[model samples]
Target: MQQISINTPALLFPAITLLMLAYTNRFLALATLIRNLHTKYKQGQEDRNLLRQQIKNLRRRLLLIKQMQASGITSFFCCVLCMLFFYIGYEGWAYGIFGLSLGFLLLSLVLSLNEIYISTKALEIELKDME
Candidate 1:
């Protein structure tokens, strides 16, 4: 059972992909918004209030993405170490690796949710905004 499970990294693939996609989407949106803001700012026509809010939102989303990516990388490293230990006959280390992976997984999920929340709130404000 352990060998069968260990042989498959498939379980993490979808989750990793989803997190990557979410992070990319947030970054792309941030890029576009930043470009627009820069243009408006240069034109001296920027809506200060809205620009302030947008910048704040972008900062938040970026922070979440950074956290997710950092955690993901650490988790991957732990997985590699786990596999090495397993191959070396140090089976006890698997438990530690399992715990690390689980923690990172939860961290990524929480970060994803946080990004979603920030995105939704920003959208809501932008939609109702008259400027």
Candidate 2:
């Protein structure tokens, strides 16, 4: 059996890393916004500012959630394609593709979870303000 080339797997590592970075970036941004909201809530009396921030956060997070879900779905399909390559490429490029796709799948799932958590938190905060 011919050995698979390292290049095959190597190509995937960077793509997966980029996806992970994207997920982390979104999470960091959300955290920052939440912290800012907390600061505004404690330091001043302008409820409007806090409310506006919350609303904006919620809107952005909702968009992020949708994007995460879509990315997750796409990653899954890529994984399937990778598996197919394993057979088609006979444990060479296919295996490499599989590894890359798997990483993408994991990253997408993590992003999806992050988006969902942020969205739920936003919804919870909104509910707390109901009059």
Q: What stretches of model 2 exceed 4 Å from their correct place?
A: 1-51
lDDT of each: 0.74, 0.64
**C-alpha lDDT (0 to 100) for residue 110 of candidate 2:** 73
Count of clashing pairs, candidate 2: 1
Write candidate 1's Cα lDDT for 11-117 as tens digits: 56566667667677777877787788789889988678888888898888878878877787666666666666667777777657856876887787788788889
Q: TM-score for each prediction? A: 0.82, 0.50
Please report, as a residue range, the 10-residue window in candidate 1 with the lowest summed lDDT: 1-10
lDDT of 1 at 8: 40
lDDT of 2 by residue, 2-77 (tens): 4655354445545655765766676677778677776776787447855786868667785775576466556655
Clashes of each: 0, 1
Q: Give candidate 2's TM-score.
A: 0.50
**CA lDDT, candidate 2, residue 60:** 75
